[model samples]
Target: MKTVKTHITQLLHAMNMGIFEKEHPIALSLLSAISGESIFFLGPPGVAKSLIARRLKLAFDQSTAFEYLMSRFSTPDEIFGPVSISKLKDEDKYERIIEGYLPSATIVFLDEIWKAGPSIQNSLLTVINEKVYRNGQYTIQLPLKGLIAASNELPAQGEGLEALWDRFLIRYFIGNIEQEFAFDQMIASVNDMEAEIPTGLSITEKQYIDWRTQISQIKIHYTVFELIHSIKRQIEKYNIQKEEVPHSTLYISDRRWKKIVSLLRTSAFLNETDTIRFSDCTLLLHCLWNEIEQIPIIEQMVSSALDECISHYLCGERTLEQKLSSIREDMKSEHSLRETKDPALQIVDTFYHQIERYPVAGNLLIFASDYQSLQKDTQKLFYVQRDKYRPVNWILKVYDHVRNRNISQSAIVSLKKGTRSVFINNQEYPLACNAGYDIAYPQEASLLFEFRFQEVIDLYHNRESE
Candidate 1:
C-alpha cells in the first residue's frame, strides 16, 4: 500500500509538472483520478483542461484506452460501436453488435462533450453511468475504469440531459492566472517548447483494481452522513441554481466527495494511522469547494464545517473568530469618535461669528478696548487657526477621553483673551481665526461650551443604559 501510494503521488507530480502553473487544479485532478472513476472538467479553452485528462491516460499507458474529440459530425456509431454486421447478414441478433468508439476503450477523453447530438449523448448515459454499452441485442460490459471528459460550454438549460451531467461526479472550473504570472508563464512556455513526455512513474493495473476495491469498502462517518444532509439543506435554503439535481442527490450514488475522503483515509492508513483523522476533512473540503456552487457559498461551507478541525491541526486553538472580532472592534471604535464629535464643531462656528461682530468689548476683550486696540493686535479682527483640522481629534485630546469609558469631569472655564499662548489638556493650541487672542481666544470658548454640552448628553445616555 505504501509503494502504491508513493507511485500514485509520483505520477501526480509528473502530471502536475506538465502544466505550466495551475497547481490547484492539477491537485484536484490527481484526487479525482485516485478514485479510478470518470471526471468531467468544464472550463473555457486554452486552460489545459483536456491535457490533464490526457496525462492520466498516459500515466496508465494502457494502449486499449481510446480518446476522441467529439464534434457535430459525430454519430452514434462513432461512440458505442456500429450495429454488428454479421448479425445483420445472418439475421442473428448477437453478431449484429459491433463495439462503438467509447465501449472499445478502457479510458476515454470525450472533448467538447455537449456538442454530441441528443441520441449520441443518450447512448453515453448508460455507458458512463453503468460502465456498459448496448448495441442491437448485446450488452457489453467494459473495462472502463476512468473517463475524463472536457467541455467548453456549461450544461445548458432545458437540454433534457440531467443524467449526463450527474455522471460526471468531479467537475472542475479552470480560470486564467493573475497578472504577476504573465511574464513567468511566457518564459516557462518558451522553455517547454518541444517538451517530450517522460515515462516510468505510473499506476499499475493491479494497484488500480485494488484502490477501486478499497473505495467500495471505505466506511463513511455518521457525522459526514448528517453533514451531507446539512449541505443539501443549505443548498435549498439559498435556492442555488444548477443544471440538474445531481444524481448523487436522488440515486443514493456516492460522490467524488465520498471517494476523496476514502482516498485520504487510504493515504493515512499507508502512513500508519490506525484511525482516520480530521485532517482528511481538509482535502475533502478542497475537492468539494471546487465542485460545488459559486465561490461565496463554497467558502462559507468550508469555513463553517472544517475550519475548526483544520485550526486545531495547525494551531491547537479556536482563535480565528476572537482575533477577527478584536480587529473589528478596534476599527469600529476608531470611527465611532467621528460619530460623537459633530456637536463640538457647531460651537466652534458660533465663536468665530461672535469674534467677528464684537472684537474686544471690555469683558469681551478687543470689542471693549476699542478699534485702535484691535488694529494694534492684527489686521484680521478675530482669526483663530486650529492646529488640527480634524475636529474629532481635537475633541478627544481636550477631553482626555478614552472610548467606552468615562473620565472625571473638569470644571468648565470661560474663554479669556491672552497674547501669550493658551493650553488645553496640556497641548498648546495656536489661535489664528479673526478671534486670534482677541475675543477671549474664541477656540477655547468654543471647546469649553461644547464639552459641557457633551457631558450632559453622555450622562443621559449612560443613565438610560444603566
Candidate 2:
C-alpha cells in the first residue's frame, strides 16, 4: 500500500511538472479516471482546462485519448464515429465504425460539451454513466476510464440537458495562474506544456482493473459518515434560508452522493489509507457546489462541519457550551435555595455580586449581569483604585433613573482554579463556583475532553503537514 501511494504521488508530481495552478484539477481528474467516474471542468478558455484532461491521459499506460470541441452542429457521427457505410450497404444494418472514436478511447475530452447536439448528448449520457454504447442492436462496453467535459458556461435551463449535467460526478472550476512568479515561469520557460509521465509510474490496464475492486473495499470511517450527514443538514439549512430565490437550493441526489463516497474511498485507497480520513472530506468542497457562487459557502460549511464533527467524535457528544450551561443551571438552583432561606441575603435592584475583599476603602461589587461572561471575561479586565470619597474611574456604565445619568461601581474580579471569585473592601466572596460547581461536573469532563480533543486535532494537523 505504501509503495502504491508513493508511486501515485510520484506520478502526480511528474504530471504536474510544468503546469501552474492546475495541480488540483489534474489530480482530481486522474482520481476520477481511476474510479471510473467523470469530471466536469467549468472555466473560461486558455485556463488549461483541456490540458488537465490531456495530462490525465498521460497517467494511464497504453491509453487512447479523444479530444473534440463540440458545437450545435456536431452530429453523432463526429462524436461516436462515422457510420459503417459498408455494413449498411452489404448487410442492411446501421452501426458506427467504433474504431477510433469515444467508445474505443480510454480517455475522452469534450470542450463546450453543452453545445453538442441532442443525438451526441444522448449517446454520451449512456457512455458516461453506464460505460456502454448502443450501436444498432449491439451494446459495446466502452473502454472509457474517464470522460472529461468542459464548458465556458453552464448548461441552459429547460433544455433537456439536466441528465447530461448530472452525469458528471466531480465538478471543478479552473482559473489562470494567480501568482506572478509562476506566470513568469510559465511564459519564460520553453518546456513542453504536455507532461511526460514516467513509463514505470503510469498505471496499466491490469492495475487499473485491480484498483477498482480494492477501492470498493476501502473502509469509510464513522466520522466521515457523520460529517456527510452534517454537510447535508447544513445544505438543507442553506436552502431553507434561500427559499425565496428560484433555483437557489443546493440539491445532491442519492446517486451523486454514492459516487461522491466512492470518489473519497478511491482517494483514500490511492493515499495508502485503509479508512477515509478527515482530509478526504475536504474534497467535498469541490463536489458539493453546483453554482460558482456556492463554492465559498460550500467550502465554509464543509470546513465548519468537519471541525464540529471531529470535536464531537473525540470529546463525547456534548459540546463545551452545553456543558457550561448545565453547570450554570445547577448553580442557579443552589442560588435560588440560598435566597429562599434568607431573604436578607438577596441583593435586590442590583445585578452585581457583592465582593468584600477589595484592598480599597470603598464598597465594591462585581457586575453579574451574565454569569458566563463574568467568568470568562472578567480576568481580562483592568482595575483601578481610588479614595473612599471619590468614585472609581472604571464605571460599570449603567443608567441611573434617580440621577438621570450613568454611574460607576467599583469591583475587583478574577477567575482562579476553576472558580470565579471577587474581592470588595477587604473581604472575599465567591460567585458561581463556590460550591465546587465547576470542579464537580463540567470541569472534570472538560479536562478529560481536552486531552482527546487535542489528539484528534494533532492528527488533522499532521495529515495537513504531510
Candidate 3:
C-alpha cells in the first residue's frame, strides 16, 4: 500500500509539472479517472481545461484519447464514428465502426459539451453512466477510464439537460492564474505545456484494475459518515433559508452521495490510509455546490465542520470541555498551584511578562485566548507602555528585527512551547522566569498540563499541511 501511494503521489506530482493554478482540478480529474467516474469542467476558454484532460491521458500507459468540440449541428457519427456501409448494405444491419471514436478510447474529452445535439447527448448518457455503447444490434463495453467534459456556459435549463448534468459526479470551476509570479512564469516559459509523464510511472491496465478492487476495501470511518449527515442537514437548512430563490436550493441525490463516498474511499486508499480522515472531507467543497455562488458557502460549511471534528478527535474520547475539566481538576488537586501577589505591572487588566533584552517601551502582554491562538499560526498582538505604574492609553511601538524596522504598536508573534521561546517578528527570545510574576514561569506541572492539552495540535497541522 505504501509503495502504491508513493507511485501515485509521484505520478501526480509529475503530471502537475509546468502547469499553473490547475493542480486541484488535475488531481481531482485523475482521481475520477481511477474511480471510473466522469468530471465536468466549467470555465472560460484558455484556462487549461482541455489541457487537463490531455494530461490525464498521459497518466495511463498506451492509452488513447479522443477529443472533439461539440456544437448543435454535431451528429453521433462525428463523435461515435461513421457507420460501416458494408455491414449495412451486405447484411442489412446497423453499427458504428467504433475504431477511432470515443468508445474505443481510454480517455475522452468533450469541449462545449452543452451544445451537443440530442442524438449525441442521448448516447453519451449511456456511455458515461454504464461504460457501454449501443451500436444497433451490439452493445459494446467501452474501454473508458474517464470522460472529461468542459464548457464555457452551463446547459440551458428545461432543455432535457438535467439528466446528463447529474451524471457528472465531480463538477469543478477553473480560472486563470491568480498569482502574479506564476502568471509571469506562465507567459515567459518556453517549455511545452503538455508535460511528458515518466513512462515508468504511467499506470498499467492490470494495475488500474487491481487498484479498483483495493480502493473498495478502504474503510469509511464513522466520523466521516457523521460529517456527511451533518453536511446534509446543513444543506437542508440552506434550502429552507433560500426557499424564495428556487435556483439557490441544493439538490443532491442518494446515488450521488454514494458515489461521493466511493470517491472518499478511493482518496483514502491512494493516500495509504486505512480509513477516511477529516482532511478527505475537504473534497466535498467541489462535489456539493450546484452553482458558482454556492461554492464559497459550501466551503465555509465544510471547513467549519472539519475544524470541529479535528478539535473533537484531537482531544481523544473526551470532548474538549471534558478534557479541560479534567485539567482543571488536576490544577485544583495541586496545592502549590497558586497565583503570585507581588506588585508587578499589568496592562488591560491582564498580567504581563516584561522583556528587557529587546528594545521595547511597554511590558509584553498576551491574553490567554490570544496565546492559545498561536498554536495554529502567527498573530499580531498589541503592546502598551506603562506610566507612573499605571496603564497608559497610547500603544507603544516595538522593534521588528525580521523586517529591520519598528512596527507601530503591534508585534507579529508565535509561541514555541518546546523551547520555551516567544518569537517576535520571527526572532526567537528565551522566555525566562521573572522573580515576582504570577503563574510561576514554566512550572513543571503547568508545562505538563499545557503539553497534554496541545499534543494533538501537531497532528491536525500535519494533516492540513499535507
Per-candidate Cα lDDT values, in order, are: 0.51, 0.72, 0.74
CA-RMSD of model 2: 16.0
Over 4 Å off in model 1, which ranges?
Answer: 61-63, 94-100, 177-200, 240-277, 282-293, 308-466
| Candidate 2 lDDT score at position 444 | 17
TM-score per candidate, chains pooled: 0.55, 0.68, 0.67
- So what's the TM-score on candidate 2? 0.68
Clashes of 3: 0
lDDT per residue (tens digit) for residues 1-466 in model 1 = 3465566666666776636666666655555555544577777787777666666665665535567778989987676666666677688674323443667775687889888888888877877767777655668787776787888776675787666776675566676555567647655665543223356566567766776666555544433443455555555554444525552222223554455556566545433344455555545444443333454565576556554334333331223344345445655664533432122211333322122222222212111211111222233212222224433221221111221123334422223333323232233333333322232323322213234334344433322232
Q: What is the lDDT of residue 267 in candidate 3?
A: 86
- Least lDDT summed over 10 consecutive residues: which range in candidate 1? 363-372
- Predicted structure 3, TM vs. truth: 0.67
Model 2: per-residue lDDT, tens digit, 1-466? 4488898889999989888888889889988999899999999899998788788888999999999999889888888899899999999999989788888999999999999988888888889999999998899888899899999998887899988888998899888889999999999988656678876899988998889999999987767877787798889899999999986789899999998999999999988899898888788987887788898999899998888768756554344445555545655665433322112222322433444444445544433432223333224332333323336422221222322111233332333222344332223355333332332232311222232233344334323321
Residue-level lDDT tens digits of model 3 in 146-195: 99999998777779998899889999999889999999999999876668
Q: Which candidate ranks first by lDDT, i.e. highest? A: 3
